[model samples]
Target: MPSLSPPPVDKPSDATTAQTTEAETKPHAQPDSDEPINSLDPQPIDESKPKSNLDLVNECDSFPYFQSTPQLYLNHVSTYYHLRVAAYPEITLGYVLPSVAEVLRGLEEWELDDDERTLTLKAGDDEPTRSAILARTTAAMREIGHFSILKGWRNELYPVYGPAPARDLLFSIERAASALFGIVTYGIHMTAYTKSESGELKIWTPRRSKTKSTYPGMLDNTVAGGMATGENPQICCVREASEEASLPEDLVREKAHSAGTVTYFHIRDSRAGGETRLLQPECQYIFDLEVPSDVEPKPSDDEVEEFYLMGVDELKEKLKAGEFKPNCAVVLLDFFIRHGVLNAQNEPDFIEIVSRLHRKLDFPTA
Candidate 1:
């Protein structure tokens, strides 16, 4: 496991600035209103655009840097709350009102100022106790219908990553609202692919269950899960493979390979209360599992409705048609790049796409 200590933070250099400019030109979808609409629909590649791939990448990587603004705004109902950077006191991360902050403060170790409308989390607190407090708060909120909790499941703790990675435990999956206040979260995704005897590559995809609280009935990867606190990426992959796809342990242990990672900032619009949920600094540790052509995945968990094996061409067409989750599409793009399916020789925006796919994220760890 890598050390949790943060690397020294630095300002974005000229090269980064140039890359940002080149990458922002591609058209990416944003929510038109406060609805959880799918925004990862593949846009028609405009040959007239000099930097098309950059735009594609930027659409998925939407979170702005903490230093870029004095404060970040979060909307709830008709009100907007400002969240300021916890470290750089002058900069705002985003906003939340006192009442909202109070609901969060009901948990342990949260510091909020009504006057400044700022929030900070105390680090190095007792893990078990903090977890308990958060769990109780989550239960209370779920009772009042703030969000639905997975039945019989406890909230999983996730480490907080930032300029100064805190040893202090951060929010759990249930309290993901805390992430919008400028915390970074992590998830794991696995791409299971196999090749036919004729050498055609096919991918294993799953449709999310209609009962899912988010992205119900949307297309997802073969297996995906959040990286709970104290769980490593490999452990997460193995567990999700079993729970979501009913893959045997031995098959996953031998076939799963750490392919790389993709990070982005996204905001999910909520139609329930006309609010927007912020996904600040989310990183997906991607893995590729080359399963045998004969192996079939059976959906073992309620999270998935069904699984299918689709050829790469069909997958691409479905992706462009907005059939897949936005983030899942980005992961597929990374797979395409690594497999040589997308390259400069074939794709005009190869450089920009490649660069944006591997955008440099400021994770707390080195």
Candidate 2:
């Protein structure tokens, strides 16, 4: 799990140019240049100093370069192209930047609809066919050096579900490439805590291994992971609890409780591999487990360095200090909100913070 450094994009040879199609000649599909035509990169946030509770929330839900206003972030998404499949006209599977749309022209499978302002993937109805086409096209993009984001690609697959209420599986995409497509990805995050004899609450937090490709050496939730293509939240939670935190399946099943979800649209920064400012709409299924005092959480894999049992006050200090991963910080904030720790009486931006934590996504989700 060493830090992933994207391979340098070599200039395309004459043979590579021969693969280009008529779609490349379209107005939106502009050729690559020394300088970008329309940059979709988001404004930067200073991560060096201590931030307020609201500031931490803004870090994960960061968007709308003009101001840090939360509502504007949602509005900003309108500017991106709607990513859809041919049959599913009503459902938006993902969002794509015009810059990304131009890159998709390199792949033969994707069809760009100029009138609809969409980049549609051309494939059949079957999941296997859609998955295979996406897999092949993304692999081709990786091989041809389409974008740096694909370089951090995990071989793992993330499902892009069709409609919100139905949650039908549309297709699957590589984990890293999902951000490039601006899709809604799901994950599971659990906050494991314990109470002393006096009822003083302490939560378990883990530090990610420094060798990790993204967000190395950062603080994460007690147990967390991405929900694979067919995995449900509860199963993902139990599995991650075992793999990441060494908590036994029976223990997790007996003690862990689903606490709902924390949704946020995050823009990647330099620490996240590949192109900075790529959009990532995520929904983390939240769980809370009050472990028995004797049950100590330990790192079961290289993904984590160590686990720390921190008091509520200490956790607050670390959160404001910007010590946790951006999305994980939002997850922790949700935990505080749910547990009545971060209340309206104490936090001034209580209402705003709560709303942003459960930010409504434009794309269909589970």
| Model 1: residue 170 alpha-carbon error in angstroms | 5.6
Taking all chains together, the TM-score of candidate 2 against the true structure is 0.84
Estimate candidate 2's alpha-carbon lDDT, on a 0 to 1 scale.
0.75
lDDT of 2 by residue, 203-302 (tens): 9999999998788998999999999988888899999999999898999988899998998878888777677767888998999999998989999889
- Clashing residue pair totals per candidate (backbone < 3 A): 15, 0
* Residue lDDT tens for model 1, 214-324: 657778989988887778899899998999899988889888999988877655434111234444556799999999877889998688888999988788777656566
What's the residue-level lDDT of 307 in candidate 1? 91
